[model samples]
Target: MGIAGESVAVVGAGIGGLSLAYQLKKQGKPVTVFEAAAEAGGKIKTLHLDGFELDLGPVSCAETATLKQLLADLHLEQEVIAAKSAVSKRYIFSGGTIHAIEPSPLKLLMHPMLSWSGRLGLLRDVFIKPEAEQTHSDETVAQFVRRHFGEEAHQKLFNPVLNGIYAGDSEALSISSTLAMVKTLAGTYGSVIKGLRAEKGKLNMSRKIIGIKGGFIRVVEALQEELGADLHLATAVKKITPSENGVKLSLHTNEGEQERFFDKVYLALPSYACADLLADIDAQMASALKQIRYPKVWQIYCEAETSDQVFDGFGFLVPAMERKSLLGAICITNLFPDKAPAGKTLFALFCGGDRPYAFEPSVEQAVKEFHSILKPSLLKVLHVQEWSEAIPQFYVGHKKLLQSLKAWEARYPAIFFAGNYVSGVSLGDCVEYGLKINSEKGSVEVR
Candidate 1:
């Protein structure tokens, strides 16, 4: 059946679902969003305490054209605020010392981040060629980094930086899927250095990171306001039955067992949840979905007694070779002053990606580990304001897995799987992809 004036049901109220709902509503389409959580934003959570705002999920985002266009369409262009341009200054632990790297290539040669011998070792990357062919293979991210840039780059550069972004394990993560763009660049120029320079405009063109004026939650709030009653909170979808023309979803809401029919249905829930929901629909798809693994990460927020001795710039990343359990830390206070009290600095500490066992530790133990690792210049005692899970692991065979998923989407022509687990993990990427999927040609039985 064709989908024109058909009803659409969106499961999950995360950025993807919210953005999709916003786009569908704009088109005057009857779209209803069902969220298991009481609030929207899904993983994009923000916490406020004593005039301080802590973004529990993604703290900042790049100023990409995709994000800019989305903001403009949502009438949120004016809400974008550029963080400190100097915030790009990064520190990495190498040979037992923290050193800052110059943001430019010329300064990179002069930068003390790596030894002369290590810099020479990096030259090998300029001459190395791609595999010259594409084959379906499962390789870890660390393996790819090591093969391309040597061990030092893997431990010191790639591990910490990638960890700070994804809260992921470099060794277990899939290189082809997570770093697809890097592979393309290397294949094109035959040198990452040359390719990065040529493709600078597209990759990090603006090179400036921006955040919402208030926080990421503001986007969710605005999206919810437009949705009004169509957005149902605490509504968990139980079962989905395929029909001749559409599909019927059995939802377990607070009221009672309600059956809703829609011509199109978007399953934007997490991988684990999505797998469970589609178990009976297609067993093979469910099995493949279950194979998608997720990492368990904990975010620790701390406040210094006085800002006088606090660290400057964004924060620092601890290399894996350092044998330190600490992944990295982001200075939230430095990024946004409005997020903390006047006299204190806020630190976003990340832990427990490879070490999920640490998640069972008591808060006191976690804080002890954090203070021992961070050892900020501040002498005053710090307190942990929050510690929560913010982990998402993308293991090997992810891209092929997503392709398999899209193939599975073919089985249920009208039921679409749209979520961070299937595509890009970034908030903007997920949301944008969700809206894009809605605009695609498809129809499934939902009644």
Candidate 2:
């Protein structure tokens, strides 16, 4: 036993699960992680194909202090490959032209594509106040943005960024679950910017986009290596039975099906998997988990010969209002030049999730559009990876589901749901939340 003679079991070996298990072990807790898949990374996998490296899952992470500290603790600080300056230059396709977002305040004011009204609306947000007695209650993202930044900023700026990240409609996604930081700022200081100012003084909350040197697969490997034999790849937790003493897991492995008892169980599984495993324990819990939605998404990988026509930037995002087959695209070479061959650039175009319909033709159209923008002497569409169930959508009422999870955790001792569906979906979010949840449980100390 690693901590106080307690045997801990973590189900699902994705980043969330792995990070949780890794931290528990670091804190002297004996933990075993079980994954249904043969590999441990989940979506954050790198595919080496055709002399190019492709990141199928999350392309980059927001290098928050939490993540930075974690990486340093894991001895992976030197492995971080900071994005090139181009990463800040994200393009947005609007009105038939791709415009780069200006970072400088002065430059942004004079940005030809940025509507003066949009900038004014954003400035107005600083002086704006919420409705009388407004609380941090559940509200749609669109509503929150529209109320604060006005329709122009919501459409041109906020919505396009959300399109690239969430793929779901801002009108449906919950502000509390999706943009909790800004929401808290608005609720506390009456303005997001004001809240940011107040919080930044209190803590070092700066963050940036980053990727591992080899790929996120390198991250998976590092985590897996750190876990060592404690991580049971291809071992599945078929069922979970919570008892008075602790919790029991019905495990299915290559050898045979066997039952194991643990002092506590942390489930870092997908909502769907959690639904199936918890059906017997509590139908209400399973029903709530099943209600969470994961729409289909497709990632199209293509390579092109470098040319003047090719833009040197992080690529473009098509606002949901634009009706483009492409939700967004990332220029792999710009971020990490080491991932591709010399004189060649790689592009990853995304489509489908939350889109009305995503088919081959749609993907083809996206490729054609990028082919035009990224004019190359030679263009080759290398691979198309389709994730049937991609990012989880946190709807307006997701708060209730979170509250229900909290309630269930309280009712059942030594049982916790620690999955993406329960918190923000970013890699940093999962890692930070995993640590915070367990830390609050009086198991491990959190800094």
Candidate 3:
């Protein structure tokens, strides 16, 4: 069946699913979105408390072309606001204090965080040569960094930075898949340093970090408005069975279990959720998806009144070697002063990534522990949110799993998959993936 008149069913109402529905609707296809939650915007939830806007998830996003286009398509260009210049001032905690990350190479040479050997190792990156041949083989982020910049650099610089991004271990994450941009730079210019130098101007121009004026939920709200009655809430897909014509979905709703047939079915949930939905239809494929692991994360939003400025910079990251209870803290007020009331500092404390199971403490207990580490004068916890399985880990063999999933998708054209786990985890990646899935002629082949 042709895509224009074909019916499409999208499971999950997250950014990925909603974006896919929007794209399909733009193509004049009959699209319907099913969301298990009462509301849309899965993890992009924002809270308003005491006249302050607190984003429970994803404080900011790196502005990208696709994201810009999405905002334009949603008529949200006027709502965009660039982050303050101070947002670039990130810090790292070491030796019981926070230090600003030096921007200049000369300043880095005398940086307090790095030892003399580590400084020397960083300078060696320019002299390092990239691999001659490109292959499908993958290496851990730690391994890749050590090979090019030396072990000290990996431990001091790469490890903590990557931990903040993935909430994962550098020793387990695939460098080629997780840090594809860095790998591409290394491969293209024969050295990361050389590639960076060549693209310095372009990188600077593209580094604008932005957020919505009200909150990120505005984007979701706009999409929902555009979709109107096509979006369904409080609905879950229990089973998915492929059919000769297309696909059959068994949905569990408030009324009862219902059956629906569509030309194509798109799953925009996490890997495990998708695995469960497709288990009966494709056991092996579901089993492969079950292998993907997602780590637990606890986010604590707090309001503190300090007589003295606690620290400068956007936030500070704690390396695993520090043995601290907290992963890191984002100075939300510092990054965007408008987020909090005057004279009050707001912070979002994060914990429980790749940490020991024993570290899973109650919200109050965790806040008390952070108080000891942070040492703020009057810190009060405003809100706490826990995600049992938060960020997905792009483990060592992730590439092979992706290849297998792609092959399965090719075999069954009626089913499509889109999620953070499938592509990069950034919001931009999800939106871009949704927009790119359909054919150039605005239609997807229906089996």
Q: Which candidate number maximizes TM-score? A: 3
Which of candidates 2 and 3 reaches a greater lDDT?
3
lDDT of 1 by residue, 1-447 (tens): 345577988999988888877777877778999998788988888777667777877888776666677788778988887887558667766665567765564566556776786566566667765553233255787776676667666776778867776767687777766777776776676667777888887875455688786789988888888899999999999888988777899998888899989987888888878888888887887887777666556677777543234466577777555545566777776777767778677777766555323334344554555565455555232334332334456778676777777666677666887777764777767766745653556421111
Ranking by TM-score: 3, 2, 1
- Cα lDDT of candidate 1 equals 0.71
Note each model's CA RMSD in angstroms. Answer: 3.8, 3.1, 2.9
List where candidate 1 sits over 4 angstroms from the true fold: 103-117, 130-138, 305-310, 355-366, 369-389, 438-447
Compared with the true structure, the alpha-carbon lDDT of candidate 3 equals: 0.80
Which candidate number would show the highest lDDT if scored against the true structure? 3
Ranking by lDDT: 3, 2, 1
Candidate 2: what lDDT? 0.79
> Candidate 2 regions off by >4 Å?
1-3, 103-111, 114-127, 131-136, 193-206, 356-361, 437-447
Candidate 2 on 1-447: residue-level lDDT in tens? 323668889998888888888888877778899998998888788888867888888888898777888788778889898888788778888877888886444465566766888767676567767653175477888888877777776777777777788878777788887777778778877777766766777744546789987677777788899989999988999999988888999999999999999988988988999999999988988998898889778899888775657678988887776777788889889988877888788888897767433434377887777666656677788889988888889888888887778778778868888777765789888888656655447332211
Local distance difference test scores for all models: 0.71, 0.79, 0.80
